[model samples]
Target chain A: DVKVTQSSRYLVKRTGEKVFLECVQDMDHENMFWYRQDPGLGLRLIYFSYDVKMKEKGDIPEGYSVSREKKERFSLILESASTNQTSMYLCASSLLDRSNQPQHFGDGTRLSIL
Target chain B: AQTVTQSQPEMSVQEAETVTLSCTYDTSESNYYLFWYKQPPSRQMILVIRQEAYKQQNATENRFSVNFQKAAKSFSLKISDSQLGDTAMYFCASEHTSGSRLTFGEGTQLTVNP
Candidate 1:
Protein backbone atom coordinates (compact mmCIF):
# COMPACT_ATOMS: atom_id res chain seq x y z
CA ASP A 1 0.00 0.00 0.00
CA VAL A 2 1.12 3.54 -0.64
CA LYS A 3 1.97 5.49 2.49
CA VAL A 4 2.34 9.20 2.97
CA THR A 5 3.89 10.06 6.32
CA GLN A 6 3.74 13.46 7.91
CA SER A 7 6.47 14.52 10.30
CA SER A 8 4.05 15.79 12.93
CA ARG A 9 0.42 15.19 13.58
CA TYR A 10 0.07 18.31 15.73
CA LEU A 11 2.24 21.33 16.22
CA VAL A 12 2.18 24.59 18.15
CA LYS A 13 4.35 27.55 17.37
CA ARG A 14 4.69 31.09 18.60
CA THR A 15 4.21 34.11 16.45
CA GLY A 16 7.23 35.11 14.35
CA GLU A 17 8.72 31.64 14.72
CA LYS A 18 9.87 29.69 11.73
CA VAL A 19 8.19 26.34 11.27
CA PHE A 20 8.76 23.34 9.08
CA LEU A 21 6.31 20.61 8.15
CA GLU A 22 7.68 17.53 6.49
CA CYS A 23 6.01 14.97 4.28
CA VAL A 24 7.42 11.78 2.84
CA GLN A 25 5.79 9.35 0.49
CA ASP A 26 6.95 5.82 -0.16
CA MET A 27 5.14 5.47 -3.49
CA ASP A 28 7.93 7.04 -5.52
CA HIS A 29 5.51 9.62 -6.83
CA GLU A 30 6.77 12.59 -8.82
CA ASN A 31 4.27 15.24 -7.71
CA MET A 32 3.96 16.55 -4.16
CA PHE A 33 1.65 19.26 -2.84
CA TRP A 34 1.10 21.34 0.27
CA TYR A 35 -2.29 22.71 1.23
CA ARG A 36 -3.80 24.50 4.20
CA GLN A 37 -7.34 23.60 5.14
CA ASP A 38 -9.50 26.03 7.06
CA PRO A 39 -13.00 25.73 8.36
CA GLY A 40 -15.54 26.72 5.68
CA LEU A 41 -12.73 27.38 3.22
CA GLY A 42 -11.68 23.88 2.25
CA LEU A 43 -8.18 23.02 1.17
CA ARG A 44 -6.27 25.78 -0.56
CA LEU A 45 -3.07 24.86 -2.30
CA ILE A 46 -0.01 26.61 -0.94
CA TYR A 47 2.66 25.16 -3.13
CA PHE A 48 3.55 22.09 -5.15
CA SER A 49 6.66 20.44 -6.49
CA TYR A 50 6.55 18.27 -9.55
CA ASP A 51 10.18 17.22 -9.43
CA VAL A 52 13.20 17.52 -7.24
CA LYS A 53 14.17 21.18 -6.97
CA MET A 54 11.15 22.29 -8.99
CA LYS A 55 8.33 24.16 -7.28
CA GLU A 56 5.29 26.23 -8.19
CA LYS A 57 3.11 28.61 -6.22
CA GLY A 58 -0.53 27.76 -5.78
CA ASP A 59 -3.52 29.98 -5.04
CA ILE A 60 -2.57 30.92 -1.47
CA PRO A 61 1.21 30.83 -1.40
CA GLU A 62 1.94 33.94 0.63
CA GLY A 63 3.91 33.39 3.86
CA TYR A 64 4.64 29.81 2.73
CA SER A 65 7.37 28.14 0.72
CA VAL A 66 8.25 24.58 -0.25
CA SER A 67 11.38 22.49 -0.68
CA ARG A 68 11.71 19.25 -2.58
CA GLU A 69 15.28 18.07 -2.25
CA LYS A 70 14.63 14.37 -2.85
CA LYS A 71 12.18 12.26 -4.76
CA GLU A 72 10.38 10.97 -1.69
CA ARG A 73 10.38 13.96 0.59
CA PHE A 74 8.68 17.37 0.44
CA SER A 75 8.76 20.05 3.07
CA LEU A 76 6.55 23.10 3.77
CA ILE A 77 8.15 26.07 5.41
CA LEU A 78 6.49 28.91 7.22
CA GLU A 79 8.87 31.84 7.32
CA SER A 80 7.11 33.54 10.20
CA ALA A 81 4.20 31.89 11.84
CA SER A 82 1.23 34.02 12.89
CA THR A 83 -2.05 33.40 14.64
CA ASN A 84 -3.93 33.76 11.37
CA GLN A 85 -1.88 30.91 9.91
CA THR A 86 -3.27 28.34 12.30
CA SER A 87 -4.97 25.59 10.40
CA MET A 88 -4.68 22.01 9.21
CA TYR A 89 -1.84 21.38 6.81
CA LEU A 90 -2.05 18.53 4.36
CA CYS A 91 0.50 16.88 2.09
CA ALA A 92 -0.31 14.87 -0.98
CA SER A 93 1.55 13.02 -3.70
CA SER A 94 0.62 11.55 -7.05
CA LEU A 95 2.25 9.69 -9.89
CA LEU A 96 3.60 11.48 -12.92
CA ASP A 97 1.21 9.78 -15.28
CA ARG A 98 -1.55 12.29 -16.09
CA SER A 99 -4.03 9.77 -17.42
CA ASN A 100 -5.98 9.03 -14.24
CA GLN A 101 -3.83 9.14 -11.15
CA PRO A 102 -5.26 10.05 -7.76
CA GLN A 103 -3.30 11.76 -5.04
CA HIS A 104 -2.45 9.96 -1.83
CA PHE A 105 -2.56 12.11 1.27
CA GLY A 106 -1.00 11.90 4.68
CA ASP A 107 -2.81 12.34 7.95
CA GLY A 108 -2.72 16.11 8.20
CA THR A 109 -0.74 18.14 10.66
CA ARG A 110 -2.87 20.49 12.73
CA LEU A 111 -0.83 23.62 13.29
CA SER A 112 -1.66 26.18 15.94
CA ILE A 113 0.04 29.51 15.80
CA LEU A 114 -0.02 31.65 18.91
CA ALA B 1 -8.27 30.70 -12.36
CA GLN B 2 -10.02 27.42 -11.81
CA THR B 3 -12.49 27.39 -8.92
CA VAL B 4 -14.54 24.67 -7.26
CA THR B 5 -17.74 25.22 -5.32
CA GLN B 6 -19.76 22.97 -3.06
CA SER B 7 -23.20 24.44 -2.52
CA GLN B 8 -24.07 22.40 0.51
CA PRO B 9 -22.24 23.22 3.68
CA GLU B 10 -23.81 20.39 5.65
CA MET B 11 -25.80 17.26 4.84
CA SER B 12 -27.28 14.43 6.83
CA VAL B 13 -28.64 11.06 5.79
CA GLN B 14 -30.01 8.07 7.65
CA GLU B 15 -28.10 4.82 7.56
CA ALA B 16 -28.78 2.64 4.53
CA GLU B 17 -30.09 5.64 2.63
CA THR B 18 -28.76 7.49 -0.37
CA VAL B 19 -27.43 11.02 -0.46
CA THR B 20 -26.02 13.32 -3.07
CA LEU B 21 -23.56 16.19 -2.61
CA SER B 22 -23.37 18.90 -5.22
CA CYS B 23 -20.28 20.48 -6.70
CA THR B 24 -19.69 23.05 -9.41
CA TYR B 25 -16.59 24.47 -11.00
CA ASP B 26 -15.63 27.37 -13.24
CA THR B 27 -12.89 27.02 -15.78
CA SER B 28 -12.42 27.68 -19.46
CA GLU B 29 -10.17 24.68 -19.88
CA SER B 30 -11.98 21.74 -21.44
CA ASN B 31 -9.47 19.15 -20.34
CA TYR B 32 -9.39 18.70 -16.61
CA TYR B 33 -10.19 16.30 -13.78
CA LEU B 34 -12.63 16.27 -10.90
CA PHE B 35 -12.26 14.51 -7.58
CA TRP B 36 -14.27 13.81 -4.45
CA TYR B 37 -12.22 13.48 -1.29
CA LYS B 38 -13.34 12.50 2.19
CA GLN B 39 -11.67 13.90 5.27
CA PRO B 40 -12.82 12.04 8.29
CA PRO B 41 -12.30 13.09 11.90
CA SER B 42 -8.98 11.33 11.70
CA ARG B 43 -7.92 14.22 9.48
CA GLN B 44 -6.70 11.93 6.74
CA MET B 45 -7.77 13.08 3.31
CA ILE B 46 -8.82 10.08 1.24
CA LEU B 47 -9.72 10.04 -2.43
CA VAL B 48 -13.26 8.76 -2.78
CA ILE B 49 -13.76 9.00 -6.55
CA ARG B 50 -12.49 10.76 -9.63
CA GLN B 51 -13.72 11.68 -13.11
CA GLU B 52 -11.85 12.72 -16.18
CA ALA B 53 -13.36 15.62 -18.07
CA TYR B 54 -13.17 13.98 -21.46
CA LYS B 55 -14.98 10.84 -20.36
CA GLN B 56 -18.61 10.87 -21.35
CA GLN B 57 -19.70 8.23 -18.93
CA ASN B 58 -19.88 8.84 -15.22
CA ALA B 59 -17.42 7.28 -12.77
CA THR B 60 -18.46 4.81 -10.12
CA GLU B 61 -16.72 3.00 -7.29
CA ASN B 62 -18.80 0.44 -5.46
CA ARG B 63 -21.36 2.46 -3.48
CA PHE B 64 -19.86 5.78 -4.52
CA SER B 65 -20.59 7.26 -7.91
CA VAL B 66 -20.28 10.63 -9.57
CA ASN B 67 -22.81 12.36 -11.83
CA PHE B 68 -20.57 14.30 -14.16
CA GLN B 69 -22.20 16.91 -16.37
CA LYS B 70 -19.43 18.44 -18.39
CA ALA B 71 -21.55 21.04 -20.13
CA ALA B 72 -23.20 22.12 -16.89
CA LYS B 73 -19.89 22.12 -14.99
CA SER B 74 -21.53 20.07 -12.30
CA PHE B 75 -20.06 17.03 -10.52
CA SER B 76 -22.15 15.54 -7.79
CA LEU B 77 -21.36 12.53 -5.63
CA LYS B 78 -23.98 9.97 -4.80
CA ILE B 79 -23.44 7.68 -1.82
CA SER B 80 -25.74 4.71 -1.78
CA ASP B 81 -26.63 2.79 1.38
CA SER B 82 -24.75 5.23 3.49
CA GLN B 83 -23.20 3.95 6.66
CA LEU B 84 -22.05 5.58 9.85
CA GLY B 85 -18.55 5.16 8.59
CA ASP B 86 -19.42 7.36 5.65
CA THR B 87 -19.68 10.44 7.84
CA ALA B 88 -17.00 12.91 6.93
CA MET B 89 -16.21 16.22 5.29
CA TYR B 90 -16.51 15.84 1.56
CA PHE B 91 -14.58 18.15 -0.70
CA CYS B 92 -14.86 18.52 -4.45
CA ALA B 93 -11.68 19.40 -6.25
CA SER B 94 -10.66 20.22 -9.80
CA GLU B 95 -7.33 20.05 -11.52
CA HIS B 96 -6.47 21.24 -14.94
CA THR B 97 -4.81 18.82 -17.33
CA SER B 98 -2.00 21.25 -18.02
CA GLY B 99 -0.99 21.65 -14.36
CA SER B 100 -0.58 19.60 -11.20
CA ARG B 101 -2.35 21.94 -8.80
CA LEU B 102 -5.83 21.21 -7.52
CA THR B 103 -8.54 23.71 -6.58
CA PHE B 104 -10.94 22.61 -3.88
CA GLY B 105 -14.44 23.59 -2.79
CA GLU B 106 -15.63 24.74 0.61
CA GLY B 107 -16.58 21.14 1.46
CA THR B 108 -19.77 19.65 2.89
CA GLN B 109 -19.91 18.15 6.36
CA LEU B 110 -21.84 14.91 6.03
CA THR B 111 -23.42 13.18 8.98
CA VAL B 112 -24.68 9.65 8.69
CA ASN B 113 -27.34 9.21 11.32
CA PRO B 114 -27.87 5.71 12.58
Candidate 2:
Protein backbone atom coordinates (compact mmCIF):
# COMPACT_ATOMS: atom_id res chain seq x y z
CA ASP A 1 0.00 0.00 0.00
CA VAL A 2 1.15 3.51 -0.81
CA LYS A 3 1.46 5.95 2.08
CA VAL A 4 1.38 9.73 1.79
CA THR A 5 2.05 11.69 4.96
CA GLN A 6 1.42 15.33 5.64
CA SER A 7 3.44 16.98 8.37
CA SER A 8 0.45 18.62 9.99
CA ARG A 9 -3.19 17.62 10.26
CA TYR A 10 -4.38 21.01 11.53
CA LEU A 11 -2.62 24.35 11.44
CA VAL A 12 -3.22 27.94 12.47
CA LYS A 13 -1.43 31.05 11.33
CA ARG A 14 -1.80 34.78 11.66
CA THR A 15 -2.32 37.10 8.74
CA GLY A 16 0.84 38.08 6.84
CA GLU A 17 2.68 35.09 8.20
CA LYS A 18 4.55 32.59 6.11
CA VAL A 19 3.22 29.07 6.37
CA PHE A 20 4.68 25.80 5.21
CA LEU A 21 2.92 22.52 4.64
CA GLU A 22 5.08 19.45 4.20
CA CYS A 23 4.27 16.16 2.51
CA VAL A 24 6.21 12.95 2.10
CA GLN A 25 5.41 9.86 0.11
CA ASP A 26 6.94 6.46 0.57
CA MET A 27 6.13 5.29 -2.95
CA ASP A 28 8.76 7.52 -4.58
CA HIS A 29 6.25 8.74 -7.12
CA GLU A 30 7.54 11.21 -9.66
CA ASN A 31 4.54 13.49 -9.54
CA MET A 32 3.47 15.45 -6.45
CA PHE A 33 0.59 17.89 -6.17
CA TRP A 34 -0.83 20.49 -3.77
CA TYR A 35 -4.51 21.29 -3.75
CA ARG A 36 -6.83 23.57 -1.79
CA GLN A 37 -10.30 22.29 -1.00
CA ASP A 38 -13.10 24.69 -0.14
CA PRO A 39 -16.79 24.20 0.33
CA GLY A 40 -18.93 24.87 -2.77
CA LEU A 41 -15.75 24.84 -4.86
CA GLY A 42 -14.22 21.38 -4.90
CA LEU A 43 -10.52 20.79 -4.88
CA ARG A 44 -8.40 23.20 -6.91
CA LEU A 45 -4.83 22.57 -7.87
CA ILE A 46 -2.35 25.05 -6.42
CA TYR A 47 0.96 23.67 -7.63
CA PHE A 48 2.58 20.46 -8.80
CA SER A 49 6.07 19.08 -9.21
CA TYR A 50 6.94 16.52 -11.81
CA ASP A 51 10.54 16.05 -10.74
CA VAL A 52 13.04 17.41 -8.31
CA LYS A 53 13.43 21.17 -8.78
CA MET A 54 10.76 21.20 -11.48
CA LYS A 55 7.49 22.90 -10.64
CA GLU A 56 4.42 24.05 -12.54
CA LYS A 57 1.61 26.40 -11.65
CA GLY A 58 -1.83 24.96 -11.57
CA ASP A 59 -5.12 26.81 -12.06
CA ILE A 60 -4.93 28.68 -8.74
CA PRO A 61 -1.29 29.16 -7.87
CA GLU A 62 -1.49 32.76 -6.71
CA GLY A 63 0.02 33.53 -3.28
CA TYR A 64 1.37 29.97 -3.11
CA SER A 65 4.54 28.22 -4.23
CA VAL A 66 6.02 24.74 -4.03
CA SER A 67 9.36 23.09 -3.42
CA ARG A 68 10.57 19.65 -4.46
CA GLU A 69 14.19 19.40 -3.36
CA LYS A 70 13.93 15.60 -3.15
CA LYS A 71 11.92 12.90 -4.82
CA GLU A 72 10.03 11.86 -1.71
CA ARG A 73 9.16 15.26 -0.29
CA PHE A 74 7.05 18.15 -1.53
CA SER A 75 6.31 21.33 0.33
CA LEU A 76 3.71 24.04 -0.13
CA ILE A 77 4.51 27.59 0.91
CA LEU A 78 2.06 30.33 1.55
CA GLU A 79 3.86 33.59 0.90
CA SER A 80 1.58 35.69 3.11
CA ALA A 81 -1.19 33.89 4.84
CA SER A 82 -4.55 35.64 4.70
CA THR A 83 -7.88 34.87 6.27
CA ASN A 84 -9.18 33.85 2.87
CA GLN A 85 -6.44 31.26 2.65
CA THR A 86 -7.97 29.25 5.45
CA SER A 87 -9.04 25.92 4.03
CA MET A 88 -8.16 22.27 3.82
CA TYR A 89 -5.00 21.49 1.89
CA LEU A 90 -4.28 18.11 0.36
CA CYS A 91 -1.13 16.51 -0.98
CA ALA A 92 -1.07 13.70 -3.48
CA SER A 93 1.47 11.67 -5.42
CA SER A 94 1.44 9.24 -8.32
CA LEU A 95 3.85 7.35 -10.49
CA LEU A 96 4.57 9.16 -13.71
CA ASP A 97 3.68 6.25 -15.93
CA ARG A 98 1.64 5.53 -19.03
CA SER A 99 -0.73 3.37 -17.03
CA ASN A 100 -2.60 6.51 -15.85
CA GLN A 101 -2.27 5.49 -12.26
CA PRO A 102 -4.49 7.29 -9.80
CA GLN A 103 -3.00 9.62 -7.21
CA HIS A 104 -2.72 8.57 -3.57
CA PHE A 105 -3.61 11.34 -1.13
CA GLY A 106 -2.61 12.16 2.42
CA ASP A 107 -4.97 13.08 5.19
CA GLY A 108 -5.52 16.81 4.56
CA THR A 109 -4.29 19.65 6.72
CA ARG A 110 -7.00 22.12 7.70
CA LEU A 111 -5.35 25.52 7.94
CA SER A 112 -6.92 28.39 9.74
CA ILE A 113 -5.67 31.92 9.17
CA LEU A 114 -6.46 34.45 11.87
CA ALA B 1 -9.68 24.98 -18.93
CA GLN B 2 -11.50 21.77 -18.03
CA THR B 3 -14.57 22.08 -15.84
CA VAL B 4 -16.23 19.29 -13.89
CA THR B 5 -19.74 19.68 -12.51
CA GLN B 6 -21.61 17.85 -9.81
CA SER B 7 -25.16 19.13 -9.59
CA GLN B 8 -26.18 17.29 -6.49
CA PRO B 9 -24.99 19.05 -3.40
CA GLU B 10 -26.42 16.59 -0.89
CA MET B 11 -28.01 13.16 -1.07
CA SER B 12 -29.28 10.58 1.38
CA VAL B 13 -30.07 6.90 1.13
CA GLN B 14 -30.96 4.10 3.49
CA GLU B 15 -28.60 1.27 4.22
CA ALA B 16 -28.82 -1.58 1.71
CA GLU B 17 -30.25 0.83 -0.89
CA THR B 18 -28.55 2.27 -3.95
CA VAL B 19 -27.59 5.87 -4.69
CA THR B 20 -26.28 7.62 -7.75
CA LEU B 21 -24.19 10.78 -7.96
CA SER B 22 -24.10 12.73 -11.20
CA CYS B 23 -21.09 14.38 -12.81
CA THR B 24 -20.55 16.24 -16.05
CA TYR B 25 -17.47 17.78 -17.56
CA ASP B 26 -16.75 20.27 -20.32
CA THR B 27 -13.42 19.97 -22.04
CA SER B 28 -12.13 20.38 -25.54
CA GLU B 29 -9.53 17.70 -25.13
CA SER B 30 -10.71 14.41 -26.57
CA ASN B 31 -8.30 12.19 -24.74
CA TYR B 32 -8.86 12.34 -21.00
CA TYR B 33 -9.81 10.40 -17.92
CA LEU B 34 -12.70 10.72 -15.49
CA PHE B 35 -12.62 9.82 -11.83
CA TRP B 36 -14.71 9.78 -8.70
CA TYR B 37 -13.06 10.37 -5.34
CA LYS B 38 -14.44 9.87 -1.86
CA GLN B 39 -13.41 12.08 1.06
CA PRO B 40 -14.68 10.88 4.38
CA PRO B 41 -14.76 12.79 7.66
CA SER B 42 -11.22 11.69 8.25
CA ARG B 43 -10.26 14.07 5.43
CA GLN B 44 -8.54 11.47 3.27
CA MET B 45 -9.24 11.43 -0.40
CA ILE B 46 -9.74 7.93 -1.80
CA LEU B 47 -10.17 7.00 -5.43
CA VAL B 48 -13.51 5.33 -5.85
CA ILE B 49 -13.47 4.55 -9.56
CA ARG B 50 -12.15 5.83 -12.88
CA GLN B 51 -12.92 5.59 -16.60
CA GLU B 52 -10.85 6.23 -19.67
CA ALA B 53 -12.46 8.40 -22.29
CA TYR B 54 -11.63 5.94 -25.04
CA LYS B 55 -13.19 2.98 -23.30
CA GLN B 56 -16.75 2.20 -24.20
CA GLN B 57 -17.47 0.09 -21.19
CA ASN B 58 -18.12 1.67 -17.83
CA ALA B 59 -15.82 0.95 -14.91
CA THR B 60 -16.79 -0.83 -11.72
CA GLU B 61 -15.26 -1.84 -8.39
CA ASN B 62 -17.19 -4.22 -6.22
CA ARG B 63 -20.30 -2.35 -5.09
CA PHE B 64 -19.25 0.88 -6.84
CA SER B 65 -19.64 1.51 -10.56
CA VAL B 66 -19.67 4.32 -13.06
CA ASN B 67 -21.87 5.12 -16.06
CA PHE B 68 -19.69 6.83 -18.60
CA GLN B 69 -21.13 8.52 -21.69
CA LYS B 70 -18.40 9.81 -23.91
CA ALA B 71 -20.46 11.79 -26.37
CA ALA B 72 -22.41 13.50 -23.66
CA LYS B 73 -19.39 13.97 -21.46
CA SER B 74 -21.27 12.66 -18.47
CA PHE B 75 -19.97 10.33 -15.78
CA SER B 76 -22.01 9.21 -12.82
CA LEU B 77 -21.27 6.93 -9.91
CA LYS B 78 -23.62 4.34 -8.45
CA ILE B 79 -23.10 2.70 -5.10
CA SER B 80 -25.04 -0.48 -4.47
CA ASP B 81 -25.91 -1.74 -1.00
CA SER B 82 -24.74 1.45 0.56
CA GLN B 83 -23.32 1.32 4.05
CA LEU B 84 -22.65 3.86 6.79
CA GLY B 85 -19.02 3.75 5.89
CA ASP B 86 -19.93 5.03 2.44
CA THR B 87 -21.03 8.39 3.82
CA ALA B 88 -18.66 11.00 2.51
CA MET B 89 -18.12 13.84 0.09
CA TYR B 90 -17.90 12.51 -3.46
CA PHE B 91 -15.97 14.53 -5.99
CA CYS B 92 -15.87 14.19 -9.77
CA ALA B 93 -12.66 15.01 -11.54
CA SER B 94 -11.04 14.93 -14.96
CA GLU B 95 -7.52 14.84 -16.23
CA HIS B 96 -6.18 15.40 -19.69
CA THR B 97 -4.19 12.61 -21.24
CA SER B 98 -1.10 14.78 -21.67
CA GLY B 99 -1.20 16.38 -18.23
CA SER B 100 -1.21 15.22 -14.62
CA ARG B 101 -3.39 17.94 -13.11
CA LEU B 102 -6.92 17.02 -12.16
CA THR B 103 -9.90 19.38 -12.44
CA PHE B 104 -12.51 18.67 -9.82
CA GLY B 105 -16.15 19.60 -9.27
CA GLU B 106 -17.95 20.77 -6.17
CA GLY B 107 -18.50 17.55 -4.26
CA THR B 108 -21.73 15.84 -3.36
CA GLN B 109 -22.23 15.14 0.34
CA LEU B 110 -23.67 11.67 0.79
CA THR B 111 -25.14 10.19 3.94
CA VAL B 112 -26.27 6.64 4.40
CA ASN B 113 -29.02 6.26 6.98
CA PRO B 114 -29.77 3.11 8.89
Which ten contiguous residues of candidate 1 chain A have the minimum total lDDT?
A95-104
Once all C-alphas are superposed, what RMSD does model 1 give against the true structure?
A: 0.9
- In TM-score terms, candidate 2 sits at 0.98
lDDT of 1 by residue, B1-114 (tens): 999999899999999999999999999897999999999999888899999999999999999999999989999999999999999999999989988788999999999999
What is the i-RMS of every prediction? 0.9, 1.0
> Where in model 2 is the C-alpha error above 4 Å?
none
lDDT of 2 at B67: 92
Query: TM-score of each candidate?
Result: 0.97, 0.98
True contacts kept of each: 0.89, 0.89
Worst 10 residues of 1 chain B by lDDT: B94-103
Candidate 1 colliding pairs: none
